[model samples]
Target: MTKDLFGRHRAVLPDWLALYYEDPLEITHGEGRHVWDAAGNKYLDFFGGILTTMTAHALPEVTKAVSEQAGRIIHSSTLYLNRPMVELAERVAHVSGIPDARVFFTTSGTEANDTALLLATAHRRSNTILAMRNSYHGRSFSAVGITGNRGWSPTSLTPLQTLYVHGGVRTRGPYAHLDDRAFIDACVADLEDLLGHTRAPAALIAEPVQGVGGFTSPPDGLYAAFREVLHERGILWIADEVQTGWGRTGEHFWGWQAHGRSGPPDIVTFAKGIGNGMSIGGVIARAEIMNCLDANSISTFGGTQVTMAAGLANLSYLLEHDLQGNARRVGGLLIERLRGVAAQVPHVREVRGRGLMIGVELTRPGTDEAAPEAASTVLEEARAGGLLIGKGGGHSTSVLRIAPPMSLTVAEAEEGAAILDRALRSI
Candidate 1:
């Protein structure tokens, strides 16, 4: 059944849509942190459906909320006021930290970011954008314009002008050998130089932690320093928290708070996990900027009743159970275990990231050459060992990405780490 479905998917879906594993998988059902495939094989889920399952698989609270909301009403569009939508917006704004925050909902992260770009350009009257290198925003035309990852970028044609910046990755760059303070200083200097040379950009968008670029990260407070410069010039700052938001990073509710010296970003776009698989995304901005557009705008299916209900329930559960703390405790142990195993493996070049978002970058022994084949081998081996993981990286996709649900347990972490250890050894 899985093989037939895989064949059908390839025949109909876009070729660019990639799938994992050699045999592929069809998940039939899930409970807690585990999922059963079509063949009735249970596996520890480490990817969490690309981190969209923020809470857990089949969380009862979210499920009940969605079912109840769906039974009453599902779609009313943005033409009318939605109680659940307004409720979720109030909750998100209260936590977003933007001054006089206003929330705009969208169906996905791509659209949420599109809305942010529109707001920035309209507010500042400039089309130029500054984005960090090795970043992946989305797949939309406007989003691809700002994307710095070459593999994910499909074309160069875009409506907006985009300039790439450095400092997203600290491992392999011109300033990799520098200390943390020096590195931040150099990056700030580079930003200053870029601004002096180019037309004034509308805003600078970045992921506090580069998600699709193999979970790479910059030094703490790098963006706070950048914020100091941009704020002086009236340039807006947009934090793409699609992957790092809602306490996934463990230390802060929003990833941008890692650079919290300057307060929150001008605009923040989030998705991936907020709805707990219900397909909800939105943008938050200061009311002044959010109201800058002359014409009205609305996402046709943005804040529907069912999805908002799921989001509200999921968010309540996240805070009530303190999943952020759980992520910190379990993810710390998981990273330590993986690092210990990587120490014995020659191909493991670096283990990086924080909290539940961890990355293991592979390279050829004694060289910096990326080993994508090694990553694939480890992925297949892990699946064979009853563990499901993910792979991502801009430089040849050689980084193993491990971002599980925030509710991950220590026992599951240990089991997944053991499987990864054996897989790395096998390769």
Candidate 2:
């Protein structure tokens, strides 16, 4: 049955779309952190559908909200005033931290980032953008144009003049050998130098924790340093929090808080996890920036009643349960466990990240060369051991990405760690 479904998927789905295991796993249902395959085999879910399941699977609040909203209305286009949309927007704006914040909804992160780009370029009167070295914003043309990672970017031809900036990844670059403070200084210096040689850029957009780039991030204060330089030149700062927002990072409610020494970002784009598996992405900015467009804009499917209701319920549950604090405590323990395991595994190069989002980079035994094949092996082994994980990175995709639901328990963390230990040993 699984083989037949896999064949059907490959026959129709895009060839570029990658699957996880040698034999693809089909999930039929899930509850809490566990999911069942079509064969009725249960597995602990650590990746959470690429971290979109913010709270947990089969979360009652979100399901009830979605069901009630769906019974009444699922979508009515942006032409009408949606009560749930307005309520969700109000809640998002309050938590956004931007002064006089306004919200614009979209169906996905790509559209959210696209709207941000439109606003930034129109407000600054330039199409040039500054992005981090190994960033992955979204898959749209505009979002992909600013992405600096080649593995995710397929084409270089784009309308936006983007300058790839240093300082996103702190482990493998020229400044990797430096201490945290010196590394921040070097990246800032490079940014200042880049500005001198280019046209006036509209904004510097970046992922606080690069999701597709192996969940990597720079020092906590690196973006604060960059903010100082960009603010001086009237350039905007757009935080792509699709993977790191709503307290998933544990340290802060938003990943930008780690770099908020100056202030909140000028524009913030968020997606995954907000709706707890429902499709909801949004951009938040101050009125001046959000209203820069001379003409009106609307997303027909964005902020439809059903999606907004799900987002509202998910956000409420997450905040009410203090999941951010849970993430901080649980994630700290999980990282320590993984670090101890990695110390004994030569192929495990590094373990980094905060909150629930963690990365274990695999490399050749004695060298810095990425071991993509090893990553694949570990993933397959983890699955065989009744656990589901994820893989990603900039260099041939060798990083083990582990982002469990924010509601993860200490026992589940221990169980997942044990499984990972066996998987790495199998490597």
Candidate 3:
């Protein structure tokens, strides 16, 4: 049955849509932090559907909220007052740390970022945009324009003029050998140089951590320094927090807080995780920028009743249980455990990340060349050992991405780590 379904999926889906493993397992159901394949074999979930499942699977609060909302009313569009949407927006704005923040809901991170780009270009009257190298924003035409990773970005034609910046990854860039302060200074200098050669860009968009580029991050305070320069030139900073939002990073509620010295960005885009499993995404911006458009617009399905209800319930559960704190504690231990395991593996290049968003980059022993085959081996072996993980990286897809639900328990972490340890040793 699984083989038949896999064949059918390949027949219907785009070829570019990649799947993991040599033989993909069809996930039949999930509960807590575990999922079962069609063959009735269960595996501990580490990727959480690419970090979309923030809380545990089948969380009662979220299920109840979805069921209740669906029974009441599912779709009304944005024509009328949406109580749940308003409530969720208020909560998100309060937590977003942006002053006079206005929220606009969308169906996905791509749409959220598209809306942000629209706002930024309209407000600043420029089409040029600055983005960090090794960043993945989304897959839409507008979002893809700003994406800096070559593998994920397939098109050269783009509506916006995008200029790639330096310093998204600290491990293998031109300034890799420099100290943290020196690296930040070098990136800032590069940004200054780029600005000198082109028209002032509408905004500078960046991820606090480059997710699909292998959970890599710049030196702390790097963006803060760049913000100082952008602020003087009236350039908006857009923080793409699709994968790093909702306290996944542990120390900060939002990933951009790692560079908090410069205060909040002018605009922020978020999706994944916040809705639990619901399709919810949105952009938060200052009122002036959000209101820049003269004509009216509305997303026919954005801020629908059902998704908002799920979002409200899921968010309430996240805050009430303090899952962020749990991510910090459990994720810290998990990283330490993986680091210890990686220490014994010659092919493991580096173990990096914060909270549950950890990455183990694979490389040829004693060389900088990426070992993507080694990553695939570890992924398959770990799955065979009753663990499900993910692989990602711009440089040949050689990074093992491990981001479990924020509600992950210490025992589960230990179990997953042990399985991963064996998988790494096998590789």
Candidate 3 C-alpha lDDT tens digits along 173-256: 899999999999999999999999999999999999999999999999999999999999999999999999999999899999
Question: Which residue ranges in model 3 land beyond 4 Å of their true spot?
Answer: none
Error of 1 at 94 (Å): 0.6
As a whole number from 0 to 100, the lDDT of residue 329 in candidate 2 is 99
TM per prediction: 0.99, 0.99, 0.99
Poorest 10 consecutive residues of model 2 by lDDT?
291-300
lDDT of model number 1? 0.94
After superposing candidate 1 on the true structure, give the runs of residues whose Cα lies further than 4 Å from its correct spot.
none
Clashing pairs in 3: none
